[model samples]
Target: MTLSEKILARASGRDQVRPGEIVTCKVDLAMMHDSGGPRRVAPYLERLGAKIWDPSKVVIASDHFVPPPDVDSAEILALTRRFAREHEIESFYDMQGICHVVLQEHAHVLPGMFAVGGDSHSPSGGAVGAFMVGIGATEMAGVLVTGEIWVRVPESWLIEWHGQLGEGLAAKDIMLFLCAKLGMSNDYKVMQYAGSAVTALSMMERLVLCNMSAELGAKTGIIAPDAWTLAALREGGHEVGDDALRWQSDAGARYERHLEFDAGALAPQVAAPHSPANSAPVAEHGGVRIDQAYIGACTGAKLSDLHMAASVLKGRKVAKGVRLLIAPASTLTTREAAADGTLATLVEAGAIMLPSGCGACAGYGAGVLADGDVCIASTARNFKGRMGSPGALVYLASPYTVAASAVRGTIGDPRDLLAMKAAA
Candidate 1:
């Protein structure tokens, strides 16, 4: 059985589970954010006179509307705190970071666990081998009332990437290439990543691959736990179990589809406005000017991601007319970046740093683009009007590309900047 099948089987008290089978599984963890947490679930729980099935098994974060830009947003945050305090949920992370990044920072997720999150990017948990997926507000409330939820076992699709990634490219580039090649029609299937390139990636990069699985329309994305995965959890202060590495797909595991790619041959990619499926090589979209270059969101604003941006922006400045905004994924990410001088490099490049939250990624809080604005961003999604005015055009790319674009004031390749810096 695949890792997902094995975990689901254990959670459901079964010997095995097959693709297309429906089963009720006990949840090992449930995660929620301010936007979708207490405010969304409190009313249903009150109506049913129910309490959280297991507060200890839950983790909540106030990521969205973090700085509370208005009264309505502030009230939402207040309700989130009240709900956690009233329920005695000690695992609540308030304004600490995006829920997904916060959980990884604190090691709340582990291999072989069955987890669910209230946000669409929940599959980010799968980077560490958890069988995690996203659910709606009603479905999340149901999980809160009862720790068991039903799921349809999905067939796995293996996307094996080999060779080595070229400089100035990253996991975000790999995922953008996939979104265009595979198109986002993979419903009821799991997008499983494997091979040398994926295994060589750091946990932060692996998180990017799984976090964007939602863009592929897959049920979730996951990677089997390896020494790298276990080590990351351990470094994050988790007392990883001895058998944590055992959570992997069996040899010759069945997969509905197996696709292979040569990572070394791939170039940096960028997705055009309205769809990640409009991706192409960076050269294809070159010379298109941008008003803003944003590096933020759970998918793009991690510490490592910030380092990538800093590398390109080191001795450069943002284009005279372009606004460069950097929003670290978490407060912890900000502190680490600052300590290492990455934050200074970015600021010296004329980048404006924003609070660490899900800012401007969902058209919430600050950094929203104005009408007819054209921006290059490092966030995962680029749906029309999702980041601001429907008239604004948002292009999605990696931190390297976004930073390079900021320096050029246009959608240019990061390799240009990297190569020039190397020569310098």
Candidate 2:
């Protein structure tokens, strides 16, 4: 069994595990954001006399609402800052990108490890071949005190895709297409990706796929660690010392289920009104009306995504009835965009620039939608009230599609816009 398999088995509390048995596993690393960090760590400190077992294994990022987006957020950051100072924690990524992105960018996650965070997308680390899970505040508190958390080792589902991804399609589309095919009911199952397509994607792209697997209700999604993953880690400042970067299934790896997608046939995907799982080919719903388009989030805030957006929006303006909000995933991403002139291109195309952070995806402060408004976004979830009034509709699409819709004022494919731009 792999590390993921071992952790899931132990976490599930099964005894005498074999090739097919389930068990519960101990968490290796734990993370929390400012919003939940104070509350979660407070309990743990109270129980353990304010002395954490290991500050190195615990990480706290002030991302949920740092720099005080509001009074409430200000208070949260203060308390979180106090906690970090008191613990002498060394692994903190303060004033950085969104927690998931920051973790990956800083190389805080490693293969064959187990991690849990207060945020839903902790599974983002699973892209690096770790067993990552998300927990509620109380559960996180327990982890802080005990330095360990348990989880049910879910049965694995093998998902394989092959061939090169076409233009305008991204790793995010792969997730949407799978969730739509697997159905929402499959949530909480472990999803493992393999085959040629998995190998073809970059580490950042793979992270986008696994990070959003939560929308499918998946326990976690992971890819076998490979050279591409190792290269990413090295670039992110990790020195692996040449340990094999291979994470392959056992010769007879057992999975409770299976799925297959043909990479060659997959078009850029769109998740229509309200559900990430309600997906279709972009063309199937390309003409649907839209009022707003967002081209940034933790999932879609990469430089490549921004470059893709800029390419589509260059020399073009957002449609009259549509509002486009362009937020980089982090201050660092924003800086990179500015340095590369992508920010200028986006602004020139009539996109409104906003400070980096969770932004509208967090749903409280910025870019809140009104009743009956329709938005196409790159955020993780489109649940009711996720970004404002429950009645506002959010369609999840890749940054490419979001950029296209910004120009068209409707759901449009990026390839179409690229062709149009070239012709113009």
Q: Whose TM-score is greatest here?
A: 1
Which portions of model 2 show Cα errors greater than 4 Å? 6-24, 47-50, 244-246, 421-424
What range of 10 consecutive residues in model 1 has the weakest lDDT sum?
A: 239-248
Q: 1-424, model 2: which lDDT tens digit per residue?
A: 5445754544555432454343445667888887777756686668767466677888888776745667877777778878888788777766676888888888888876778889888889888988788888888777776776655556788888978788778888888887788777765577888778878887878888789878778888888888878888889899975563544556677788777778888888888877888889888897889988987667887776788889888889999989999777777778888999999999998999876677788684478899999999987778888888999999988888889998888898889778877788
Residue 56 of model 2 has an lDDT of 87
Task: Score residue 107 of candidate 2 by CA lDDT.
Answer: 84
Residue by residue across 1-424, what tens digits does model 1's lDDT show? 8888988899999999999999999999999999988999999999999989999999999999989999999999999999999998999999999999999888889999999999999999999999899998899999999998999999999999999899999999999999999999989889989999999899989999999999999999999888888888988899997699899899978999999999999999999998999999999999999999999999999998999999999999999999999899999999999899999999999999999899999999699999999999999999999999999999999999999999999999999789989999
TM-scores for all predictions: 0.99, 0.93
What is residue 211's positional error in candidate 2, in angstroms?
0.6
Please give the lDDT score at residue 231 for candidate 2: 83
In candidate 1, how many Å is residue 72 off? Answer: 0.6
